[model samples]
Target chain A: MRQNRTAWFFLSPSLIILFIVGLVPFFYILYVGFFDWNAFSLQKGMHYAGLENYRRLVFDQPFINSLLLTFRFAVYAILVQLVIGYVLANLLATDFPGKWFFRVIHTIPLMVAPLAVGATWRLLTIPGFGPVPFYLDRWFDFEYSISANASQAFWTTVIMDVWHWTPFVTLTMLAGLTALPREPLEQALVDGANRLQVFWYVKVPLLRPIILSTVFIRLMDALRTVDEVWMLTGGGPAAATRYTGLYIWRIVFPKTDYGYGSAMSLLTLYFTILISWLLYTAIGQQRRGER
Target chain B: MKKLITLVVLLAVVSGFGLTANAQDDNWWATAAAPYAGVTLHGVSESTPPSNYAADVLAPQFEALTGIKVELEPTSWDQMYDKAIKDMEAGSGIYDFVYIEQDIVFSYLAQDYLVDLTQALVDHPELAAPDFNFDDFTTFIDDFKNAEGHVFGVPMEAFVKIYLYRTDLFGDPEIQAAFEAEYGYPLAPAATHQQHEDIAKFFTEYGEENDLDLWGTTVQAASGHSSSFYEFFESIAPTFGVYNWGINEENWKATVENGGQMNSDAAKEALAWWVSLLQYAPPESTASTWDEVAATFAAGRAAQGWVYGENTAWIASDPDRSQVVGQVGVAIPPLAEGVMEAAEAGTGYVGYYDGGAFGIPHSSKNIEATLLWLQFIGQPSVQPEWAAAGSRIVHDATFDDPLVVEMDAQTNGYYTLLQEQGYLFKGAPAHPFHAQVRSVVEPFIWQAIVGEITAAEALDQAAAAADEEMARLGYGQ
Candidate 1:
């Protein structure tokens, strides 16, 4: 009883904050999702129209487009980031000259604001003023403008996600690499295993937990990415890069359709929870297998 | 005991300092208005003031006049709207004065979020000049009053969309001769959608041959409100006779379909013409918003660009802002074939849309002070000052002022185009779901422009969606 009381006292502040900022608002948003609420109206009264917001979402073409785009972005971004991060982590674990410099360079993009990075890339991709298109035109003879093409916009967004966040995965895997039990690696090395075999057999297997955790984290971050895409193409040419976050923002701000926004947000929350559950299950399976 | 007393006293002093800092009212609004003396008025703007014209000018001037202090709270356009809506919804008095878009006033008014200014104007008659004729305001300004005939807001500025072109680029003899030979008319700013497309194609082909790397025109195709797509569409809609005439007399619902009266055969043809011009526009135009379009013109890549009247000052004042500042010329948009036929028969409507207005909130504590500020801002004495300082003013008398006329002439006769074209400017319907309708329509219009869907299909989908939304909101139906 004493231990429970002490624990509760220690957690009291966080619990209070969670209730006020998180739980209360979450429930209130759910309540709001039922009504036809416009954010700018003078009337505070909300009429109860149960399930209307959700029903509308089912019929909303744009909302569905945004969801599909988000999923596509997430799949492409996560797979690319994971592979690149793992390779880079393996490279960094070895003794190489200017390793610190390379690591610092890798980390720099992560430190820069995502939106600023997107804007900078946009400036660099402008037809004549930007050097990328100029160089591409000069060398490869391929005249391309990423801002104009929807496919190019999608790829650019993927590349931007990799550039900004692969460092996070690299750092996580690096820690995992450093923390691995040396005995197994030594035993494998002694048992006539080659360097490649040892790495593939021992290091990667042990680093699964860290890689899974990093993937989960990146998955959530990728789901919420709006600022970079917003600054770059703004889901444009025609609804090409509209993410879930941008959709919700349009609802809450421009459309002032908070009820629909909340419904969409609740749906987003459910998806996020499902993703988290899957990650947890995957991690648990990997851990149990290792045991 | 002595140490405990010392600690308590120190804590008290620290808390006192924090409280005092939060309570300080150093702005001009706090010092100027008699009723609001020692009270701070938070003023928010969508854009940062130009270096030559900062809030300090109005802050000090207002303070000296009214003894009230005004604190300037600057934010980006999107952020300002978000904050304004949140504050208004919560009934939080965080902002005493807000600069909002004209289209949004209906939604704000419907909510009773804005104060009625009729009584305030009557009570503060001294604020008005002997020549402070409300009649001087155009019908565009007068139409924004609430249904009860209460003036909720005063017109802050009037901006009409005009076509800006580069005289130097089009003045070349060879290019001019070729254009006239091909189009059977003098090479000039386009006067119709067909003319505009022909000119754009000609310029794009010629410019490419010359290695000039210039576009014939630029239009915004971004995904948000205030995207120039709407303005571009609006400029040609009247020419096509595509207009939201009014609500149905019996139904009281939005009129979008019914053989596309607003979304008519002519409008679709106009849209197709616009889409064809995209080939002449810079490839990046698909992602361009209003700011990007402005930048495209400023960069000297576009031979002609559609822009608002206020942007003329923006281009002229900053050398770094535009490459063809001295060389730019303005003209009213051209009439379409349908409009031309109507004009030949002496029956056509040539109208642009007004952009923004200013209003006091219903929760304002100093109505008289706000009214005074409104009258002062609208005065002929202050109108030219605001215009000269790079903000647009709505008064007709101000346009005739020597300084304003001289400035306009110096900046390539933008004022003349404004006065001629400004009178024809109308506003969109003030229904509550108007904003929602815009959101649904804008995206699909882009889809149509990009050929993801046909114009007719996009219009039908948007109309059906809008109708559903209006019905859901228990409006229009």
Candidate 2:
């Protein structure tokens, strides 16, 4: 009992902080989500809305569209990042001349602020003045205009996210690769297995947990991305890039519809939690089956 | 020696009058702002030319005259509205003054978000500057007034989105001859939609043949920005005889079947015409707001375009900012059939008369100080230089000021047009749900701009969405 009291005492501050910042807001949003409240409407204060916001959200085509778009964007971004990041990590694991320089250069994108990354890409892709279009037109006779083309705008945002975050994936994977036991890798080699076979059969199996963790983290982060995309295209070229986060932002900030935004936010949170559980459960089940 | 003596005496007499006027102005600030001397006023505004003048010039002048400090933050448009609205909603008393854009003032008043400037002055007459004459401001002030005539804001800047063309291109004998040969019309400022289209095509082809890095026109058609929505609904649709975003004020219906013209034949034609111009405009048009449109014109990449008047002064006279400084010309927008007649009869307007005003929020702790700062800026004595610097004329006296007259000449009669025909242009409607309705309606317009949908389909969807949204907001009901 004395030891339990001491542990409780030690955990009290962090618990309080979490309650204040996390639980309080979560509950507050949950409560507010039931009322139709517009922050800008002084005359029409909070009205008992019940599930009206959720009902409307079901038919909110823009929000639904944004969710689908966001899902596709996350799938593409995560898969690409994982593959490129894994390749780069393996390549960097070997010693080479100027390895430190290559590592630093590869990691620079992770250090850049998302806003700066968006802005730099904007300047780099702006037609007439931007060098991207100039070079593309000269080299391949291809016209590159993000503003004029929705497909181009959407892909550019994806490319921008990849550029900004692939380094993070690479670095994490590199750490995991460095920390590998090496016993299995050496054993496979001693058994006359080729390098590729050893890497695919032994090394990958050992690194699966780390890879799964990285994928889970990247998936969550990509789903909620807003700032960089906002800065780049503002979810435009016909909102082809209006992800779930930007859609919620439009509701909460510009429209000032607190109730609807809160409802949407809560729904998104539920979806995220559901998705994480499914992913975790599926991966865990796969590991268990293999065992 | 006799002539020099006479000139010196004349200079001294003029200097004395100025000194006496300065002394009187100083005395008013000293007396009116005495109580609020140590108080600092916090304000937030968009970083436009006029707002910059208020921050960089008038704030310091006010501080010098009255020991009160003014911390004015001029920032991006989105940030300005977001900051101001959030501060007002929270009632945190963080901002003493905020820029109430003409379009959003109705919403602010509906929310009771601002202090009634007229009533505030009436309640505390001591805060009103003696030189601040409300009557000196033009009728544009009517836009900021509630139904009870209680003024909520002091007008800072006012300008129309005028049609700008290249004088050098139009006057070029070779180009004019070539254009006439092709279009079979005397090349001048477009008086009709057909003429504008012809001019656009001619200039584009001409640029290509001559190997010049130029386009025919500039379009404010950013597929994602709100400026494109404003451009279509306010500037272009009005010229096509669709007014007030085609929503019937009485029933608040936006669909044509319900007596609104949002998706009417005229509005569809207008949208089609605007989208077609993209072929002749710079590729940047698809990503442009009013700011990029202005920059594109200033860079001389286009021969003609619709430009906001606030950018006219610098683009026409400041060589450092504009390559076509000496080549710019201003004209009224091309009108559709009966559009001019409708505008003249006060039933419609030609284009957007955009502006903003400084108002004290009800949540402000320093309303009295902020009021003095507003009155100080609203004084007619400061109107000419501010008007000259910002290309905005809010007061009648600014029209006749020598400095403004000189600027008018320099900008090819921009102020003259404003004085004579500003009534033809109108601000946004008194929609208390402006932002809400606009947010719902603009996406369809974006789809049209990006070729995701046709103009008719886009407007049809937009109109239906606007009607449903307004009803949901309890407006039409």
User: Which candidate ranks first by DockQ, i.e. highest?
Assistant: 2
* TM-scores for every candidate against the unseen true structure: 0.88, 0.96
**Position B128, candidate 1: lDDT:** 42
Tell me the tens digit of each residue's lDDT in model 1 across A41-140: 3344676779988998999888888988898999999999888998899899998999999989999988999789878877877554578878988899
Weakest 10 consecutive residues of candidate 1 chain A by summed lDDT: A38-47
* True interface contacts reproduced, per candidate: 0.38, 0.62
Q: What is the C-alpha RMSD of each candidate to the true structure, in Å?
A: 10.9, 2.1
Local accuracy of candidate 1 as per-residue lDDT tens digits, B295-349: 7877788888676556677665568777776777777677755664554354455
> What TM-score would candidate 1 get against the native?
0.88
- Name model 2 segments beyond 4 Å from true: A39-43, A282-291, B1-18
Q: What pairs collide in candidate 2?
A: none
Q: B1-477, model 2: which lDDT tens digit per residue?
A: 999999999999999999998898799889988988989899999988999999999999999999999999999887898899999988998999999999999999889899999989999977778789889999999998888888999999999999999999999998889888888889998988899889988888888888887898889999888889999999999999999999998998999999999999999999999999999998889888888999999999999989999999999999888999878899999999888888889988899999999999999999998999999999998999999999999999889999999999889999999999999999998888898888889999999988989999999999999998888777776
DockQ of 2: 0.64
- For candidate 2, chain B by itself scores a TM value of 0.96
